[model samples]
Target: MSPVEPFSDDSPLGASGAEGVRALRVAVTRPLSGERLENLLRDAGHAPVHFPLTRIEAPSDPRPLARGARALLRGEMDVLLLTSVRAVRSLAQALETVAEGPWRRPEGLQVWVIGDATGAAAARMGLVPDRIPEHFVAEQLLEEASSWARLDGLRILFPRAAAGRSLLPETLARAGATVTLVEAYRSVDDGEEADRLVRAMGRGELDLVTLTAGSQARVLARAMRGTRPALRCAVPMVAIGPATRMAMVAAGLPEPTVAAPHTVEGVVAAVKTVAGGLQ
Candidate 1:
């Protein structure tokens, strides 16, 4: 699915146009070779290196997630918060297992997604989001969600990975919302792929690395443990959002060029801008 939104303007550095990207060897962090994220890079005229840092796995126990799906279908939850496209898919899987017939939007369930990609995924499952923020960041979501609806005393069902940033749920809890988190999936670091990334970096074959999450930065750092710190600091990188930028820094990697609009298209623009500077 081409969840990537098209940017109307020229690349800020003037790289993407009729001629395509500037032949930059950009390293896309996830979504594999055939996904739209990689295709977006290829269609832009950039050579995108596949770097799968994390793989989504079914949780050790799937019962909780299944129960969450039932709750969603029954309209027992007042609000639904979806942050990633994977979460949407996992929830949908659960729904398919318990659903007796065609998927229908549960009445009275106000769906809220973090980004256009997540929202699109939700819609594909017949779940329409009631609110979406202009910015995709979780912090921004918390800040902007105030204008949407009464968050206090609401039962928010959030089906997410086993481990993730706790800011959203924690803040919602503080806001007096009883948030029930169901581990719909597990985001595990791929050790083999991380090793390959390290070798590529040592060989100086990578022009730049693109990171989509703080978790990716942590995984990259772990994989590059024995390498000289200079190697990591030297390689150009771009973070998909501010939270990721901070995670990169905390993990001892260089601060990356934070992508604006926090989308694949924005990452491409950042790569073009970085490539222009490199030239």
Candidate 2:
């Protein structure tokens, strides 16, 4: 992908002069989906660092998901909460393995998405959400749960990564809802890439770091902690959503620029805004 472009106005680092520009480093911690953020950062004249911390892995057994799909069709699930596009895509793929032709989403199913992207993913599966919260986090989702009061006795199906924080499930359970947690996928570490990131940070070669998800932020924090040079780098971080921003903060990384709306375009806009403010 092309590097992120600079802001239309002077960048924050640009105001600092050549020395400041040299110190402006960015490190991308996750695999970028589009070129908007990268292009914006590069245009701003900052050296962009691209380091993907984890690789997405499909589940070893699709049987559970297949069963979940069958249950969903039978109206066993009252609500479907999707937190990520990956979860939707993984569930769709799993469904195809056991289901023939186009599988229709059951009616009367209250669908809730954590964000717009996840909603779009659900739309791809021919399922539109009943509600979508503004903040793309489990806390936000829980707070918005009141909207589905009619779904009181509902059985909610949450398909997510195998290993992740239990906030969503725990919160739903506390809300007096039956939540079924399914491991749709997993994220595996990339050691070689982690090493490259550490070396790049040590050399002060990175410019802007982008974290698309909370899981990615956690992976990055772990990787950085393992290397002192990476920890000492002063690269600015860009979080795609609140959860990611929280992860960055919890990891004690430098304060990050959080994207509004929590979308890819929002992230790109945040980079441009931050870059411009830098000047």
lDDT of each: 0.82, 0.71
Global Cα lDDT for candidate 2: 0.71
RMSD of 1: 5.4
Task: Candidate 2: list runs displaced more than 4 Å.
Answer: 1-26, 32-49, 226-233
Q: Give the per-residue lDDT digits (tens) of candidate 1, residues 1-279.
A: 112122324443335532543556667678455688778877766767787888778988999998888888888899999999999999988889999667677788899999899999999888888889888989888998778777788999999989988999999999888899999888888777778877777876677899998778899988988888788877799999898999999988887898887988888888878877776
Which number leads on TM-score? 1
- 10 residues in a row with least lDDT, candidate 2: 14-23
lDDT of 2 by residue, 1-279 (tens): 234334335555344432233324566655543345555555555545566677788776766777787788777998888888889998888767667767778878888888787898899788888888767777877777887665456698888888877988887787678888888988887766766765666665555577887777666667677565545446666788777788788876777888886876677666666655655
**Superposed model 1: Cα runs more than 4 Å off:** 1-21
User: Which candidate wins on lDDT?
Assistant: 1
Each candidate structure's count of clashing pairs: 1, 26
What's the lDDT of the predicted structure labeled candidate 1? 0.82
TM-score each candidate. 0.91, 0.81
TM-score of candidate 1 relative to the true fold: 0.91
